[model samples]
Target: MPSDNVYPSSNGPSQVDDTIPIAQGQRTLFEFGSFDHSKIPLEPEEWPVIIIGSSMVGMTLGVLLGYHGIKSVSFDRHPSTAIHPRAALFLLRSVEIFRQLGLEDELRSESASNFDLDAGMIIVEKLVGGKVLASMQESDPAEVAKASPSRRLWLTQNMFEPLLRKRAKEFGAAQEFSETVVHYEELSDGVLVVVQNVQSKSYRKVKTKYLVSCDGNRSATRRKEGIEWQGPGVLGESISINFKADLTPYLGTRAKHGVTYISNPAIDAGFRLESGGKAGFMIVTRAGDKKSFSPDSVSERDAKRYFKEASGIEDDIDIKVDSISYWSVAAFNAERFMSANGRVFIAGDAAHVMPPTGGMGGNTGIQDVHNLAWKLAYVLREKASAALLRTYDAERRPVAGLLMRQAYSRLQKRVFRTVPDEPELPDIVCEIGYRYPSAAAAHIQNPNGDQYEDPHAPLVLPGSRLPHVLLSRDGSQISTLDLIKTNFVLLTTGQSSPWIEAAKGMTLEIDSYSINTDTGTVRDSEGTFSHICRISEGEAILVRPDGFIAWRGEWRKDGHRDELQKALERTLYLSGSKQL
Candidate 1:
């Protein structure tokens, strides 16, 4: 654990601007801090992990790390969660992760269930006329459910972020809003971070074992670390008009659809339901393909005009414009995710930026922190070596790169009417099918080169997500994924008692479960677990803490212990724990 001792460090504010936007709507209902900058402690502080930025990705990381019993402190320039409903789409894979944190019920209640709607994109002349120009279909609900326990949801960032902040607090993460990370210095043992109060301009230092920056695309930490971006930089920029208006009358039957693209000579934009259709927003200007509307220059008259025109409701309605925001549609990946010293890491938009056509930017970031949280916990607990932390960049960077290209391709095809020659993976595959590179799965040698596998037909291969299988525990139905939390798990059939016994001998906290057809520890009443997972009698699959398969093969009577030990040691870098 990192010490809570305080020491003085001198540094100026970061060159990057860290301005806090005004609080919006009922956002203050869930404000993280009191917004009193004078109350900020003058002395330096220390923590195991100090997170920069407390929005979606940062808050999620704090919650995840807290869930693993690791204390952390997060700082954000924002006065509250989110001033605007920035990103609204959450893939089923992302929701499944939320479900793991016991947030499924609250999220599903607050967000619109995509499964209940038509769940697809439609290009229309206007909301009232509904003259279709083009359309795209979403994945079948049945197909999606077969891959995970949760479905996709449409909750705006403004609504979603509060939940994460609350959960993070419940898990003992200290979130200090109106605080900006100004500068950080990496030491051989820890990092010294200086943060300034947005209102008071008071500066304080934080010393942490690890510093994670989730400060969005223009991450000061990433820039300070001199990480360069790869691929097409900024595709374009657009204006997002967030507002609360009853669109049901204008939408009418079109309300069933998830997203609507409004196209006409007057304006080209996209619309989506917010707060479960009680309110909504519009993305004006294709950005990459059209004019870049400046958020500052968008007057109330202009915003109302665009809103009414996009809705085809020129007749006045009670359209309350909440906020106007601007964003870039870009495809860029950082040259590297971690600083040279490896004490500072970047996740979410700081690490990779992709076009929003596929609604992957925030989802990808959620998975990025999910992949990292457990590894940090393991190393902090001395269960794994510091070397295990390096795999976070190796595993998540490639996945982010793949999604970046995939999202760019979708932007070209869906918005621009120009299909890229590069093959694009199906949306489900992009969300959950991505396979970690072979180097991340050091226990496996010469793994397949495929970037992703079909989620519908999961191979349960090493470096792949653990295949979802329905099993029963205490007569209650559960997913194989449910068995995974914050520890390595060894999954095998009832006949693989040798593997279970081998796991028992290890001092590490390795949870072993035996799935059986009729009678065993975990009953596979559906009798499809072995077939779906491709595991037979005497065969076992070793899963990592993050629920990715670390190793899988037939268990040998003479070498079961050695093989399991070797797999754990190699995958966790346990053999290289010189720091211990």
Candidate 2:
């Protein structure tokens, strides 16, 4: 439905300058005119990838595609901040991804310190007419530390987005603000997006090979495409208010213990410290019986009343109201993540929205972008078949379904106050348990007969994530994850000439490294992968470009060359003859 105009005639906003100021030493982020298009080997007619919405998902996708040497355009409707007081928890896996993008330090610096909080779930019971509740004690920090290497950070969406936006600009996929997509049409080869700049009052049509809708729950693209979400709608309303008043004074001793959940019938509230106490305090309240609670409806007086009722605080409470907003606990999965017209796709809330019980929503969206980024790059670079894109839906849809189910489960557990006898935490439910069922994983056979049927268990199968393990080779301890550096790694448990030959043949195009476990050394002349791949048996494994294992077997086994060729073909989407 977008207009046929290739470029709009009018300029940007009159109030704001059309041209952005160039940094003192740094060059302008991206070139805008036709000349910029001509610089690439691809013609202007080549479809550009346009990502709608500039949330974390959109920003991540744009940055990844840009890093992969793909031309992409990202646009958002809002001039500045639209959503507020959103997702506060970023999981460990997300941290790993951020580390890879080199934004981990910036995120850590800008965001809050996670170590201070006692994040485990707690149960509470209120005595008649009493303000204090019989609350469970916080988990010991040392004990919680033993569960996982990474802990979820407590940071608001406001703090997180700016970092992502800045990083996206640094990666050369700077997003355009105040640009709303009016309409879009999917052509045979690309998608045409008609966008209007709300600030400038101008319009332009962009042709993109692929179009991704990272727009939130009420996505315009999804609606226009007649994609109906098929799950539970707004289950309950929750109010989040940001205040400066330290509740710690009231609960002098309890404050030392973190994340107190008040369960009194009169007042149900959850409180946590934000940004190591620098970004004020966060108070969450379930809008009991109220179908909806809007920011406009909840006055400052109401907040004060609730705070007093929740925590017997009547003393001189100096509170600065930063912002307050109501959120819906909705659970819905898109009927389809990808359009039948292959050029269109959806990620994040646009594809699925879940209740924020386990903080699965944001992390799932992050994974969605991670999955799509490489696939898009592969297709664009002609390294793989277009069919590889279909695998995205296959792999992610099921994962989304599982996440929603987990969210519901977590919600039930929270509501019922179900305390397990052992109090075992389902850590892997939101952690590194997701597996891709594409051709890459399909090629893997469980040779060791099924003893453990737990699908969510850490993957040790071929073509799966090589589980992290600690190793000390010649006194230097190294992690298994360090060996993988965004390239193919052939991990050999023993000497194998054929494997080396295959790796050498593909070294011209693909980055291939052979690790000889017998000698505790890798093919990298710089000795980067040597310490990481410390296998000392006859069994060997091959990892794909994205860190997942591509093949695993004993060295020089029967049909070893044939199986290796098949694995390479499936992993890289290359023909049999292409495997030299």
- Can you give the lDDT of residue 65 in candidate 1? 94
Worst 10 residues of 2 by lDDT: 12-21
The Cα RMSD in angstroms, rounded to one decimal, for candidate 1 relative to the true structure is: 7.6
lDDT of 2 by residue, 223-279 (tens): 666677776555655666667664543444444434556566556666655533333
Find the candidate with the highest lDDT and give its number. Answer: 1
Model 1 spans > 4 angstroms off: 1-45, 113-118, 275-277, 286-290, 443-447, 576-580
What is the C-alpha local distance difference test score of each model? 0.78, 0.60
lDDT of 1 by residue, 147-190 (tens): 88778888888788887777777898899988877767789999
Q: Which segments of candidate 2 are over 4 A away from where they belong?
A: 1-47, 81-83, 112-119, 125-150, 256-258, 275-291, 416-425, 443-457, 471-478, 495-497, 507-538, 558-562, 572-580
